[model samples]
Structures are given as C-alpha cells and as structure tokens.
Target: MKIEVNITKEPTKEPISFEIVDMSKKKYSEVKIYIPKKKGRKSVAPGDKWYVYFYWRDPETGKMNIKCKYYRGINQKKTVAEREEVAKAYQRSYQMLLEQGWNPLKNKIKNQRSSPKKQKHTLKSAIEYALAIKIRNTKESTARDYKFRSQFFLDWADVNFKSGLPLEQFKLEDFYQFMDYLELDYINKASGERLSNTSIDNTRRVISALFTELKNKRLIDTNFVKGIPKLKSEPLKNRPFTHSQLIEIKKYLEEHDPYLIQFISFLLYPILRPIEITRLKVRDLNTEDWILGVETKTEAFSYRKIITKMQPIIGQMELKGYPGSYSLFTNENKPSIWLPKQEKSKVNHFTNRFKKVKKALGYGKEYGLYSFRHTAIGDLYNSKQAEGIPEQQIIYDLMPITRHKSEAGLRNYLRNIKIALPADHSDIYTIDF
Candidate 1:
C-alpha cells in the first residue's frame, strides 16, 4: 500500500476541519480527518487544533495497509517546514504499523473506543483481597485474629480495607507512621499497655502479605516493605505451678466443688487443654482403658489418650452423686447446662476460681490457670528423660497429644516446659519421675 499526504486551507468555516485520504488505487478509498472541538463561540482557538492519524488494510489477504496521519491545525498557523515535519513523523508511525500488518484507519478508531481502562487501586482493596484469600484457607479463630488486627491498620492509616490501594503508592513513611500509631495511640482495653511489639509485628506481616498478593497479580510494581525490618520480641517468662501447689489446688477442688475435681484431673492428669476438656462428651470416655478421647482444635477427628492420674478421678466421679450421662463439670444438675461457650471467658472464670483457692492455701499470685498445662508437660518431659528417652523421641510422643503442627512448634513447647521446670529437685519437681 502507498502513502499519501495533503495540505489544504479554507476560509469562512465555523471550525476548521482537516482530512487525509489514502489515494492508493485500491478496492476501498479509506479516509481519516481531524476535527477539533470548538471553544466558546470563538471562530478559532489555539488549542482547537490536533493531529489525527489513520490506516486501512485489505481484509481479504491480511496484508499491509495504506496509512495516513493528518496534521490538523486550527487558529495556530503552521509553517511549511513544521507541516512537513509533522507529516514525516506520521509517515514513520504509519510505516511501523504497516510492517506489523496493522490497519491504522480501522485499528485507531477501534482503539479510541476500546482502550484499556485504568482501575483505582487503594490500600483498602488490597486488604480485602488478602483477607478473602485468608478466610478461604484459615480456621475461624485465625480469621478472627486477622480481622481484629486489621481494624488497627485501617483506623491508623485512615484507609478503607475493601478498596485496596496500589502497592507502589505505599511509602516507607507510611510504615513508620503505622508503627507510631500502634505504639503511641493503640492501647489494649484489657491490660491498658501499649500494643506489644509482637502484636504490631503481626499486623505488619499481614500488610506485607497483602502487598505480596498485589505484586503476584501484577497489580502493583513493587512491595513497599522490601527493606523494612520486623519488630523483635523478648523471650516469654515461664509461669507454671509447683507440684505441691498442684496438689493443694486438687485437694481444694475435691473438698469444695466436686465438678472442679474432674476439670483439674482433665488438665493435670490427662494433659488436656481446657477447651478440649470442655468440648468432651460423656461418650468420649473409655472406662475400660481409662482413656479420654479429645477433639483437638486443629483437627476434626478425635484422639484417644490415656491419663493415669485421671482414672481415679473418673472412678470418683462415678461414685459421686453425678449421673453417668452428665458432663464431667456442669453449672447445673445432670446431663446438660448452657454455659458460656467462649474459651477465653471460661478460662478467665477458671483463673478467678483458682485465685480464690490460691489465697485460701496462702499461695501467691504467680499461680494461674495455665500453670496446670505447664506443670503436666514439664512432669512428662522429666519422667521421659529420666527413663532414658531422647529429647526428640519425647517431643515426637508429645506432638500428637499437644496437637503441634510442626517440629519447630513442638520444640518451642518443650522450651517453655523446660523453663517452667524448677531449678532444685525439692522446689517444684513432680514425684511421678
């Protein structure tokens, strides 16, 4: 296809219009024009002029097409050299498009109508997407934690979580501001302490993940936190009951609240989490084997594990006035009672009751509800070690009962157990070993 160029001037026109025709001897005589928008009632305006380029290719053979770019100028006059330069630039672009077998006249019109639209990406939008992805894969408790912490991010940054901003738009300054907001402004309602570094770090990690998703989708150019450092946390202090303290609590529960006796046995004897114990039904117990079937938080299927100390307690419960069908612990008489199902609230109540027992026995504030779990695990670790069991083997045995997901998780649990153990044998060591 041959190229054609034209220059023309006409007077007495309302708004000047320029047209270019592909004068090649072809089947269809394709044409393109430049018509500028009029400005207010003015006959001519400098901004009213523009260059409109076009191309036309044969539809049958799928070959090269004739192309043209008409340099349309309105009130602003152009010199011969300027017009020639504009024509030459258009010719170059036309030739490039022709080489790619693009019909400028047809493609340019289509492109003008169907050009790719830009979406408004915000920080809020990214968070929503990230949260949706998390909800699909994570447990309810995990999803709740993410949702709870996400509010801090939204309130601090003053961004909506649903309308995610582009990742590229985030600056280092924004991160520093967020951290400052968490440290200075964000306060825990329960403890009134400034948000902990660990908590803040978790929020940061979520934000980082959001940006990662955006980058993966090619929605953003870069992750803003590429060089940012994670917040550090101090080692947690060990807090667990001494063997004598455990015995004292058990005796108090046996005398005062028979229901609590079974609960304590579930904790110290079988090494069951309070939630796992509460979730247990009468049918979950194996009287013959003295095993308690516990449904773990992570898994759907229950696990049956023996609790030697619990055998006597279970027999005692059977001997007591409680019915066989009743829960080991209940607020009301017999089979069923609707108590608070929230684990944290139940734990808090247990802790308060434990405090009363501790005060009665003259034990200090150091003993808490969690002490029972710590003491049980510590006792097991010591007993296994004394029996010539390797640390790894002990960990492996405890992993299923503890419901730890990874070897690292089990190792951390063991580390805590060791920390909770007494320095002197006579101070807090269990007699079971």
Candidate 2:
C-alpha cells in the first residue's frame, strides 16, 4: 500500500490540485483538494482553509466512503508559494498515513462489524416493519394516513414482483416503475377512480418515508425512494360555495340534518378545519370571555373569538351540561362521550354526512366540507370591502378570525383561493363599441 501524492497547479484561480497514486497499481476513487468557496471572489483568499478529499472502499460492503485530511496550517503561510509548500507537506503526511493503512472510519467500521447483524427483510416485510415503527411514533390520524398511503405501494409490489423479493433487490429503477404504476394504472379500490397527480405524489412521500426507515434500520444499503424526483402537482383549490348554494345548503341542512348545521357552524363562523373541529372538547369553549380555544394544526391549542354569528349557535347547544372531557362535536353532532377508537372516525362522519347533503343537492366533487370555511372567509372579506373598510384594517381584523400568522400568509391564502374579486368589472370597463 505504498501511495504517492503529486501536486499540480492547474491554470485556475482558486486551487492547487493533487492526486493519490497507488504503487500497488490501483487508482484511488475521487482524490482531490477541496477549497472552500469565497463570496465575490474567484481565487482562494489569504486565510481560507482547504483539505485533501478522497474515497475509501470498504472491504465488507464494497462501498466507497468519503475521507478527508484538512490543511489549516497552509493558511498561516503569508505567500502563495509558502502556502503551496505547507499544503504539499500536509498532503504528503496524509499520503504516508494512507500507505500505512490508516483509515478515518476505521473505528467506525470496526464498531459496525462488532455490532449485532441487522435483521434481513423482504419487500413486504420491510414495508410492514417500517409501518409498525411509523404507526408507533405518530398520532392515530397520522398513522392511519401513513398506512393508507403505504397500501398503494404494497399492493403494487405484490402484483408486480415476486412475493419473496429481498429489500436490497428493490432498486431505484423499480421505485420509478412503481411511480409509473401509480400514475398510469393504479385506481382507488374504494373510489374506483384514478388518483390525481397530487395524490400520486403523496403516495411517493409515504413510500419514501418507509424506505428511509428501512435504511436507518440497516435492512437495506440505500433508500431508492429518495432518488425518485417529486412530481409537480397542480394545487387543488376548493371553490367557495355561491350565495344561492349557501342558502340552499343552509335550508336543506335545517330540515334534513339539523345536527350537521351545528357542525358546519364551527366550520363557517370560527373558520375551523374539519379535523381541528373534531378534536375540540367542551372545556375549550369560554362563554364568559366569548373566546373559543381551538385545536390548531401546528400548536397544542389557540384561541379564536366567539363571533356574533357563533354566539347563538353555541347558546342552542347544551355544552355546559356535558362533562368537560366530552368532545364538542360527536357522531350525534353535540358535545358527548367520544371513545378512543371513535376519534379516528369523527372527521369522516362529518365528511360523509356533508357528501350525502351535497349529493342530494346535485353537487359535484368540487364542493366539500372545507368549501364552507372558504365561503365564509371569502364572503367576510367581500362584505368588509363593500363597507369601505381599509384593506389593511380588514386583513388585520380577519387575522385572529382566520388564525393566519402574517398578513402576507393571509394575503397568499386569499389569492390562492381566488377570493376578493372586483364586482361587475365588465360594466366598469365597458365602452361604446
């Protein structure tokens, strides 16, 4: 293992390069000098640190791992020639150590070898194992979501590959094939419809998570899922319900499923997400201060004022009568006992109910439970604009109501939802043509 180091001055501005020559007649992988980049400068500055970087191939795994020998003392030299001499000296010392079988990762490699062998995994087993770990760490709703997305890849693998395919055998190319399957052939067993690009991308994320877990557990060498590029997904914006549609829905819910009206009120007035509303308990409401403690997506909880619209709705409900621990919105659409298992179904209960109402009204997929929130926010913005309220004041007022952190965020949300359109623009722009 007698290795030689040779320095070469390329006609470049920043670097004095070097290479490792193996006297045993073998070439070392990726041997070079690494110079730190300087802003607004093409050449290496007077005090910039650099290093000799190379790769060391592992005997067991045959993996080329990175190794570096830094040359900070080179910077202490005042002149270019002096610095080059010091760098060469350091490089030679490093080359000698390499010839003597010195390895930066020697201790790491020994520890890895001494450690217990990782359990082997098949494609099916690896996915299941990863899912188990994921399910254990995440919340029930999140765990369910992970599992739901994972099933798509699991089903695809079962059909396409041998049942006993080893985890290592599933390469980057195979993952791309699975992605193609998702894009072209896969259909939802429940909906009997092809998944949108966004849905497919979501599935990609879940699969990526699983592969990452497997890699961490040492079930496989590489996470092929990470190599797959993310597909660009067109954002799916839910349209706000028109005034006539809102009136129709309100009238219909009042007669058919009045309980749902209470649930929708939470979405409409407080502008709560369906999931957030489901997580709310009776104790969260403060009638004295007219403040509603909301379960937010990011934080443990947040507060929103009980607006004039929601005041009557809360008064109608016998929330105080129930135990404070009881969920605010139950299957019965009132504050009542909610079992642990029932927590998962709370959002779906309202969503399905809303779907039924939409179906009866001859509504399409564009209208959803979220549409109520968008509709309410959009209408509020339009109403305030009509009243000649300053736009900044209107946005500031809506901030606490919508729970947006910044004016820019709220503005972007309004823009993304296509709200606050100027009324009768055609009439204003009309000319005698």
User: lDDT per residue, candidate 1, 87-140, as tens digits?
Assistant: 333444334334444544556633622431233346654565445445434433
Error of 1 at 349 (Å): 3.9
Question: TM-score for every candidate vs. truth?
Answer: 0.57, 0.62
Pick by TM-score: which candidate is best?
A: 2
Model 2 TM-score, 2 decimals: 0.62
lDDT of 1 at 385: 73
- Worst lDDT 10-window in candidate 2: 109-118
For all candidates in order, the CA lDDT equals 0.58, 0.73
Q: Model 2, range 1-433, lDDT digits (tens) per residue?
A: 8988999988777688888865564324534565556675323465576656667765455456545455544455333334443454445444544554556565442343233133445777667756655544344456567877887677778888733687777777787888788788877799899878878888888888887887776667777778777777655646788899989998999999999988889989989999999888899999999998886776667788898878998998977678888988888666787654434577888889988998999998877889989988998999998887888998999987788899999998898677676544465765877
